[model samples]
Target: MDMEYLKQFSLDGKVALVTGAAYGIGFAIAKAYAKAGAKIAFNCRGEKHMEEALAAYKAEGIEAKGYYCDVTKEDEVQKMVADIEKELGTIDILVNNAGIIKRIPMLEMSAEDFRQVVDIDLNAPFIVSKAVIPGMLKKGHGKIINICSMMSELGRETVSAYAAAKGGLKMLTRNICSEYGNANIQCNGIGPGYIATPQTAPLRTPGHPFNEFILAKTPANRWGTTEDLEGPAIFLASDASNFVNGHILYVDGGILAYIGKQP
Candidate 1:
């Protein structure tokens, strides 16, 4: 392998702003960026989560800055981005990883509940991306990675709102690429499969029906880990994927491709 070719993967000295990185997938990606030599900046809506996230980064020997901001609010997102530019330099990469999911059957889900999910999952990405694009244009290149989901493509019971929001997010990712590719900004998404996180621990418990269902559906016969997503995230955010635009890299343990064995 050519060592020179591998240099494209290095994120040395780049500034990365990963939203909702206080924990879980966002945290994993932020940690990976720090390891890959990027300056890490993350946002949390709550002060408690911000404190914990900073401490966690410290424990990992990473010098990360955490901000308190509500991504769904455009003013707050803009302010946070401005602060990041001042403190960390122009953001070279952005991960719209902040989101929420509310599982409720469509018929029973109230309009308020639906709007709340859409506001966080779909609209906030728009607000945050908008805030950072100008800086990216000034810097000459940028990468925007949206944290999509399996629901982006498939619709299941009790997730009408989530599916709708993610589907919209998928289109938003493409639209961003269409609008910004000429400016050297690559906008893409990562659709995660069943990951074993705290929120899903109950479903992942041995002998749980949902667990068996997911295992049967996924060709890998297992759940995905946050670690499984790090490489793809880095690839999209680094120089390596400069030409790869408007794409959704599904890190789903093959669930999206498998049809499952016959009952």
Candidate 2:
């Protein structure tokens, strides 16, 4: 293998902003970017999470900068971006990893609740992207990776709002690519399927119906881990994916392609 070919995957000197990176999926991606030598900046909406996040990064020997900003609010997002630019230079990679999910049934869910989910999941990406695109354009190249969900393509019970928001996010990713590709901006998405996070540990216990169901539906017969998403996230945020845009790379265990196994 040519050593020069591997350089395309390096993010050295690039500045990356990963929203909602206090923990879980966002944290994993940010850690991966730091490993690839990018300067890391992330946000948390609350003081407690912000403090904890800074500690977590430090534990990893990463000197990550954390900001307290609500992504759904444009003004707060704008300020965060400006601060990041001042501290870390213009952002060359943006991972729109901040989002929320409301698993309420359609009829039972209130419009306000639905709107809140959409605002964070869909609109925050738009707001944050708008804030960073100008900097990216000035830099003459950039990468924006939206953390979409499997719901972007498939729907399940009790997730009406999440599905809608993620579906809209999918289109938003494509639209960003369409609008900014000419300016050397590559906007893409990562759609994770049934990631096994601490929040889902209860559901993943042995003999759990939901766990069994997920395993049956997934061709890999296992849940995805945050580690599983790291490489793909790195690729999308690196020069390796300069030509890859407007695409949702599902880091699923083939759940989207398989029907359930026979009983």
Candidate 3:
């Protein structure tokens, strides 16, 4: 590969803040950024999570800065950003990866449960993004990557609240791009397919109905891995994707494009 082409992907001297990065997909993305030469910073909602994340990063030989911040709380998010700026640097890359979902049917789900989902998934992204944009504007360049879901584009059973929040997130992604693209800030989203993670291990057992359904629906014939998202996350957060704004890169192994085989 041309050195120039590869150089476009380098994130040296950049500071990245990935929310909810204690483990799983968010952790994976943060690791990738660290490997690509960006300074890693992450936030979790509690001290225990922060301690675990710091240990994990240290074990990986990454000097990551961890913070305890509730992304859904605007004041807390602002304070965290200020601290990150003071301790690390202005955030050049912001990954809105903090979110929660309640797998309950719409008719059976309580309004409070629904509100919690939206608050974390949709409103928190807005809060964090708002907090960081001014600094980005002053710096004259920035990347905001929202960790959306397949639910952003499609609905599934027992995930009504999740779907609603993700769907709203998709629009928010585009609107951020519309409002800031001219200012050299690119806001995009990543919609992951069913990824094989510890949280989803039980559902991935062989012969399980949900496992079979996922495999059948995914054209790639398997669930995705955290590593599967690393490259896309890096691209969206790097100079390589400066012009790629307002798009949701569905890293779903063609599940969205396929209609599935006939039974």
Candidate 4:
């Protein structure tokens, strides 16, 4: 690789916008991008939490600002992206990390619940990508990383809606890659294993069957930490992955590979 190839992995002077950046995986992604020298336009639903994330980033001496956007709302998302570009310049790196995962029985899930999952999980990436693509095309380069889930490929009993949405996200990532690859836009998906997010705290209790089952299924024998995701996030968002398009990179601690057969 040439010197330029090495610099491609450096995101200095790049502008990144990460949604759901208040906490969890999204927060981790934003930090990773910032650490890679990209300025951040972090998105959160409200002001206070947004302030917290921005403050934290500033403490790292990274250029970062927060925007408020309810991703499920079309107008809000469009306006938010527009404002980010206006204020932060061209969005060179866009991480579609904001997603919601719910555990509800298939039969018990309402039409509204299913729609909500689709809106947040599958549709939000499309919305943000749609808003960011033109600028990227104009610049002739951009990177988009969608936070898909292991459920994108596998189905579980209570998470049918989440599974469907994540599955759709994986396909959506590839579809966008196909449509925009010639435009120098790289789109990819990241599938994380069962992570120890606040949303999954209930399962973190001792002897929680949910936690134990996930651990047993995963070859790494541990719950996924947000810290486990930083490096992949940086690589995908940086020029390091310039030729990597439509790839579904699983950071699953070997869960996807094991297939859960008791040996």
The prediction achieving the highest lDDT against the true structure is: 3
Error of 2 at 96 (Å): 0.7
lDDT by residue for model 3 (1-263), tens? 67887999999999999999999999999999999999998988778877888999999999999888888888999999999999999999999998988988889999999999999999999999999999999999999999999999899999999999999999999999999999999999999999999999999999999999999999999999999999999999999999999999999999999999899
Instruction: Write down the TM-score of every candidate.
Output: 0.98, 0.98, 0.99, 0.92
Instruction: Residues 1-263, candidate 1: write the lDDT tens digits.
Output: 89898889999999999999999999999999999999999998888888899999999999999988999999999999999999999999999999988878899999999999999999999999999999999989999999999999999999988999999999999999999999999999999988889989989988999899988999999999999999999999999998999999999988888789799
The 10-residue segment of model 3 with minimum total lDDT is: 43-52
**Model 3, C-alpha of 88: deviation from truth (Å):** 0.9
> How many angstroms is residue 242 displaced in model 4 relative to the true structure, after the best TM-score fit?
1.3
Clashes of each: 0, 0, 0, 0
* Local accuracy by lDDT, each model: 0.94, 0.94, 0.95, 0.87
Full-model lDDT, candidate 2: 0.94
For residues 18-74, what per-residue lDDT tens digits would candidate 4 score against the true structure? 888877888788888777788888778877887788777778676778888888788
| lDDT tens digits by residue: candidate 2, 164-197 | 9999999999999999999999999999989999
Q: How close is candidate 4 to the true structure, as a TM-score?
A: 0.92
Model 2: runs farther than 4 Å from truth? none
